[model samples]
Target chain A: MKLWTLTEGNKEFINETGSITKFANRFFIVGMKPRYEFKELLTQCYLIGYKSLPLVALTGFIMGLVLTMQLRPSLIVYGVESQLPEMVGISIVREVGPVITALIFAGKIGSSIGAELGSMKVTEQIDAMEVSGINPFKFLVATRIISTTLMLPILTVLADAIALFGSYIGVNINSVTSFSLFFTQVFQGLDLNDLLPAVIKTFFFGFAVGVVGCYKGFNSNKGTKGVGIAANSAVVLSSVLIFIIDLLAVQIADLMGLNY
Target chain B: MGNYAENNMRLGIFVLVGLIVLIFAFYMVGKNKSIFGGNFELKARFSNSNGLMKGSNVLYSGIQAGTVKSLKLINDTTIEATLLIDNEVKSFIRKNAIVTIGTEGLMGNKVIQITPFKGNSPLVKEGDLLESKKVASIDEMLQTLSRTNDNIAGISDGLRQTVVEINKSTLWKLLGDKAAANGIESTINQMHQASINANAFSKDLEMILSETKSGKGTAGLLLTDTAFATQLRMALVGIKSAGDHANELTLQLNQMASDLKKDLDNSNGFLNFLVKDSLMIKKLNATMDNIEKGTDGFNQNMEALKHNFLFRGYFKKLEKEKEKRKTIDQSLRIDK
Candidate 1:
């Protein structure tokens, strides 16, 4: 029985991977179609990006604060506590700001996408849309994926800015740094390479999170319990994909000689 | 439709703000790179770029004044770097500035440092080639450091061996011994005594030096008394004149002695005969004896003449005349 169950799990894993790839490919096809869901895409962008700002800002601010406070003693040990802002800036602009914001985005946006579509699937709304010749894939999946793809980079940028601002506040918590000086120090260490790669990777991160969430939701079981499972799995898978994408992004950046 | 439009407006605003933030980031990075500002191109050449790349920072006196635009290896040993420098720093960089490649931090990116010279020179113009300085690359520095580390290790090993040898020697044992301690103590005591003597000698020397400083002694007078110095100089001049006179006199005496010696050397010379001829001396003695006898005979003849009566009358008349003249002369000369 254990052998059978392991075999079944492997098959299920392969099937899930194939299904997601198919869904992503179908999204690409439907998303590039003529009737672009401009209004819905805008609504999703508002929902995904603007509405998520407060939480992202709070998280970003806290991230900067906690990281700076935690790093101070260690940096002070090396007598480079003065470079705290530059260090924090490089970290946020390079790695922390995008990755942390994406993780938070996956938790919030990914779960919502999954639960919304999952309930729609359970209620036969998607099927109803398909019968009405609405091309549900274009209306629902493509729009959300495009919105995530477009919106995440913008969100990541805002989040990075907030995080740096938070980092400034953090730097001033124990030691006094003027707002101008803190920002100067931060921008001083940042390069186009650092900013570009981090921003670029968020696009991929958003696409992955959106696809996973939409895939989980649109393909959820016809039962009530499936909605919960879909939402939970969507967040989990999107979170995992965020790390994977981040890894790929770093590798690609390194290959392009942008890692410096 | 109204709600949808409002949502779209919110989304538009959000997207605009994000783009603005991103553009601002780009602007800041570009500004740091000296990209957007008014700038001019300058050239620097280096023997080795030391991993310097395009877009590396150019620091002017430790401030970010520019960035490297391109680096091309012009020859086997020279890398020509084109720099985009801000126009604001144009007045500061001199024509004779030295450019060097250095690291940003311990393990950071390579940076170009433009070190300006202090003296008068023209401000650096665009396209003018600034002098490049060859800096030790990290590899070379590490190589030197490795060699130094090896030397230190060898030295430390030698020191360890020396310590071992010292441990093996009897010195430590001697130091621990009571008898040796006593001998060492005596030696230290002798050294202390010698040091005290040396210190006392130093003090005496210092005292002599102080006396010299006060200008009181002969040395001091010679050094400080201007009037005495002038008198001494006059005396020296007089002595020199006297010496010159004595030298002339000595030279004259030497000439006379040389002439006298020549005369004496010739046996027939009158001055030689007068000086040292024995035969001339004998003849002169005989002549002198004959003169004396003749003078005695004349005296006898005069006495005889006076005794004769005829001579006596003449002599008496002459005597009377001489007496009369003497009386007349005496009377004339009496009180005059």
Candidate 2:
């Protein structure tokens, strides 16, 4: 029975792998088609990037503040509390800021894209667009994927700034540090390698989030209840993909000897 | 369309802000790398790089001034590190500057430190080789610490062995022996007795001093009695006077001896003649012998006269007359 269960699990894994490949093919095909509506892309950018900023900014600030507060006692134990800004800055820029902000973006933008597309699929709006000879995938999936791919890095930069500012405030709450000094210390240990690789990885994070969300939503089934499932699965899958991309980015950066 | 315009404006603002932050981040990181500044290169040769990497911060007096450009091996034993320093701080880094590798914190990144030379030495020219010092790395320090720990272990083992051998020694056994212990005890007791005797002696001396202070002993009387002192003075004066009289008697005896010598020198004196004349001495001796013989014959004649009959009657009458006279005198005294 255990062997049967294992075999079934293997089959399911193979089926999921096939579905993923099909989704990737469709995503690439849709990406390659030159019917990119700048208007639609702008609209999706507005929805996915600009609309999500406030929440991302808020989460980024709280994440930085809480991270600083949590890391303080450990650094104080090592008597390196003076290194808080630099340490936190490197962590946020190199790893935390991009990953956390992307995760948040995944949760907010991914679920929104999934739900909206899933609803359109459920209501047969996508079907109508297809019958009317409109390229729904171009209007819907490609714009979002492009917008996310472009916007996430920008958002990550902004989030990293806000989070560093939050960390400065957090530092000032315990110790007395001026903004200029905090920024100076934050920049002192930082190099282009630390910033560039992390920023580059966020583009991938954004792509993963967008592709997973659109894939789940575009292929959503079961009608009304499938919208919630699509939204949930999109967030879950995108969040997981964000970490995988980060891990791959780190490994690549290590191979390139950029992780000094 | 209005909504799209608003969204576009918002997107523009968002992208613009993001670009500004990204630029600022790049600027800050570039500034740390001395990328945005006019820079000069300097080189240093070291025996060991000590984990100093390319792009590690170059510090001047603990302030970030530049970054390490590259590290290349010059030979089997030496590594040459190139530093890109900001041109603004070029004057401060002189030709005599010393470059050494150091760590950021206890466990932080390695850094290259440039110690500027004092005085108006010439500025370090581009590509000039500054002096390099190899810092001790953590591994080296740990190896030294490990050697020290092994030495400490060796010393402690020796000490432990010494202690164990001492514990097993004859001296230690002797200390534990009853007879030796008794001897030590007796010696200690003798010392205790001596200490007690000394204490008693000091007490007795203290008592004597106290008695002397209170004028209770002979020494105290000698010290305190003023009348006795006066009598002593008087006795000393009398002795002095007697000594003077004895001196006068001695002078008188000397004068008598001189006068006797003068009398003896006047040869007419009988003692002088007897001392000077040998014939007179012989006559004096003959006269003394004749006197002695004559006295014996006289005493014999007197005895014969007392025994002769004629003489005896006369002698008897004379004796009777003498006796009668004595009786008559006695009767006269008794009658009166």
Candidate 3:
């Protein structure tokens, strides 16, 4: 009620961490059993991945356009404006495309999952599903987690392509460049190291976002007021986790000598 | 059901497009790396590799023909480079082809450049070692440039020392220091002073010449006065006549001496008899003695007569005449 006292915040933090661990264990165990609700998983995949495309694409496009515009004056100082495609391509493929798309996914999907499940929990729908013996964790949580894990990589790849197209347009606003030459420069500057490591890390980002959302919503309390808190905390936690995961991915890539 | 079908279709389309993009990207990267192309491995041995890396582009005639496959140190001084050349361009790379390491741009990556041999050489077989030309590395070029700069600096130092020596000596001499014994300035200054003196002497000569033209001095009169010149000419003529007359008188005197000698030899003249005849010379001597005595006696008589009154008047008149004659003779000698 008073937000938190020191002792209460510490106690709540410990409880949340324990709940996340138990939820993660249940999510993996349920994810492994092959009694997947195909129709529900498909519907969730469509909702999580496809419904999020336009927002992801728009944000991806603007992100690339703004990045290129901001980078232009600095690169012009170095007289390397001709290398804009290569530089922008490498940056998007290795870092920007995946991270930004994942953050957007976290905001849109993470908040949605938390609020939807939180309201259902407040309405006693999760209890009803459990009483009916329908395995709500698998049907609700596992499908969403699996859908997010699968969809984010696909989304990232699409977002990266769209962002490069946006960067191309950004390049053309000031200078003329043939599309073939632009793409060639972009592809020439990228290696498997840039593409594979970035794509691989989005799986973890999707998992973290989904787990945080489900953990918040599945443990909702304090009635309708807790529903809003769950959604807010899901977005906040998933965003912070995205940066942390990105940092760890870079370190791992660096350790494996995959980064140049 | 219809909405679900539509969503599934959209998902399928999205996944398909994403896959195509990924496949295309991978294919482009693989093609550039020569992974998808049919390539043959060829090795070249070089003394220096010039920082050429494993994935560096291989070029033939300024076009991309292949990529470097691997590099190994063959020995301490040589590097063995394996190149994967595209099979399509392999036929053009003859057995005599030359490989050299070069750079992409001024600050770009290193590349391997192959020069295909001209006409009718056998094609290079797979794994055949091509001829390699060692290019100068940036470090080597910088070292040679630094050595050349050092040589130029040394030469400039020598020239500066020579210039400094010249300046020290010449400047000292200009300030009138005699210690700069070999200074050119001193000789130049002496020549300058001599020129100034010559200019003054010429001016003096010009003044003398102008005065002579105006008939001002002795030389001016000699040069300009005709009357004075004529008088000088007459005096010179008179001197010449006097010299001729004196020469004539000497001839006459010599003739007289010869005539007297002839008379002495003939013993016909009284002067000859007086000189040659002993008995006549004796009588002549006696007569001269008597005459001398008589003259002495006459001088005594004159002295005695000077004391007498009547003779004193006569002697005074004679003395007066003698004095007058003596004065006249002295005047004549002075005139001569």
Best by DockQ: 2
Model 1 interface RMSD, one decimal: 0.8
lDDT of 3 by residue, B1-336 (tens): 998899999988887887898788778877777878799999999888877888888999888888899999989999999999999998788988889999876777799999987767899899999999877788989999999999999999999999889877957556676555546668889889999999999999999999999998889999999999999999999999999999999999999988998888887787877777899988978999999999999999988888989778887798789889888899999999
Q: Which stretches of candidate 3 lie over 4 Å from their true place?
A: A1-15, B48-50, B171-336
Clash count, one per candidate: 0, 0, 0
The lDDT of each candidate is 0.91, 0.90, 0.90
Compute the lDDT of residue B87 as modeled in candidate 3: 92
Please give the TM-score of chain B in predicted model 1: 0.48
Kindly list the per-residue Cα lDDT of model 2 for residues A48-166, writing each as its tens digit: 88988998899889989998999999999989999999899999999999999999999999998999999999999999999999888888888899899989999999999999989
Q: In candidate 1, what are the lDDT values of residues B135-197, reduced to their tens digit? A: 878798899999999999999999999999988899978868999899989999999999999
The lowest-lDDT stretch of 10 consecutive residues in candidate 3 chain B is B173-182
Could you give me the TM-score of model 2 versus the true structure? Answer: 0.70
- Fill in the DockQ of model 3: 0.54
Q: Can you rank all candidates by DockQ, best first?
A: 2, 1, 3
C-alpha positional error of residue B334 in candidate 1 after TM-score superposition, expressed in Å: 86
C-alpha RMSD of each candidate structure in angstroms: 17.0, 11.9, 10.3
